[model samples]
Target: MTKRSTPSSPQSRGNAPRKSGGGWPIPTPGDVLCYAYLWAREAAQGQEEGLKDRPVVVVLAATDTGNGVRLTVAPITHSAPDGAEGAVEVPLAVKRDLGLDRERSWIVVSEVNGFLWPGPDVRPLADGSPFYGAIPDWLFLRMREGIGVHAGRGRVRVTKRTE
Candidate 1:
């Protein structure tokens, strides 16, 4: 399990609790999670975005560390940014399986982050929510490969088709 140091002064926004260990179910790889993200300000760009609650795809399986589970995830956005490199377009089948309402969405593989689950920062998608469901194993593997390639980790070569 990878260890991440806690920020000295963690930013808090919206109704998300500021501590770890909640009753929320620990999300596994392939699960789409919904949470409030306190995106850091880009001072040079003169921008301050706060409390964006949205769906993110769990790219790696959660590792329980007694206190809370650690998760690596990539953001799922309805709008695909123009010329944004390393954005993997989510297929219609996978989107339908995940119960996403958007006609199209992309997994931002380059924007992966390690977060503590059942913590103030991350939580499961609400019951009956459109963003609640798991992607198929093939899609999950493709996402993992996308992340690996984007991060300059060696590419994952898969030749088998699950169809």
Candidate 2:
């Protein structure tokens, strides 16, 4: 996957803050590809304005031997207009079972860190308590051969939403 340059140039002055938290590198293209499944859904639903400023988990899966499933989970920092950070994880046994010898193996987002923001810096507080929050217009609930995308908008507590 191609590496995305950090938004540090003077030209990026108007860009939203690079990050709200520290300790991680920006999202990679592969990370972005994992989320492509969501894009497909969002586009299909004809919704495009939502999804910014949220933590999202992208999950991908592939079939394995009988009675088992292959799964991967990734934690992604969703920035707006075009920036994100991500961390990918998979079970060692599953990896071997699925022959995941390359980085292109399946991955998914299990949780989100914060609410999806508008643009990049703004966070709208809920008018009521325990805001149910908004689901991205684009969410991949299913995958082809048990592989697809999902959007949680923040660090998902459960890495694998399902087996």
Candidate 3:
């Protein structure tokens, strides 16, 4: 996956106060992040394809590691829900608040992943100026609720949520 310039030194990335002795941006719950995910393809020899760069919402608060922060994120997809089992629809207002260009998108709660901040596979959104922002608190709470319900079904593994 291609890498963008590293997120502007932590202080300018978000409104959240910088961590003491800051190293990486401390992503808060509801923050939207850009990431490149590798999706597996149904092919011989377990071939896979990259999902390329996309926006993902930070569902869990970040943990500051001295080296970098780790975050749990849910990918935002433009696909129709069609009653998909674990898809959580992102409301228009929430999308607007997050500055997402797509009019309609779904947070694939079942596909959450842990990412290291400012890493090659993930970084803050910066096309010209920093566009990194957070979704509304209410929307984030609803998504977390959906994730909990989905998790309780025992379909998504605990390791996927924790690791």
| Highest lDDT model number | 3
Greater lDDT among 2 and 3 belongs to 3
Local accuracy of candidate 1 as per-residue lDDT tens digits, 20-126? 34434445577676755333223224433224767777776555566456777677777675645557788887666555674788876655656556545554444
- For each candidate, what TM-score against the reference? 0.63, 0.19, 0.69
Model with the higher TM-score, candidate 1 or 2: 1
Error of 3 at 144 (Å): 0.3
Superior by lDDT: candidate 1 or candidate 3: 3
Which regions in candidate 2 have their CA more than 4 angstroms from the true location? 1-36, 40-85, 91-93, 104-106, 110-163
The per-model lDDT (C-alpha) reads 0.55, 0.27, 0.60
Please write out the lDDT profile of model 2 over residues 6-31, one tens digit for every residue: 31222222243432222112221122
Taking all chains together, the TM-score of candidate 2 against the true structure is 0.19
What is the Cα root-mean-square deviation between model 3 and the actual structure? 7.5
Better of 2 and 3 by TM-score: 3
Off by over 4 Å in 1: 1-20, 38-50, 62-66, 82-85, 123-131, 153-163
Q: Tell me, what's the RMSD of every candidate? A: 12.2, 18.1, 7.5
| Candidate 3 global CA lDDT score | 0.60
Ranking by lDDT: 3, 1, 2
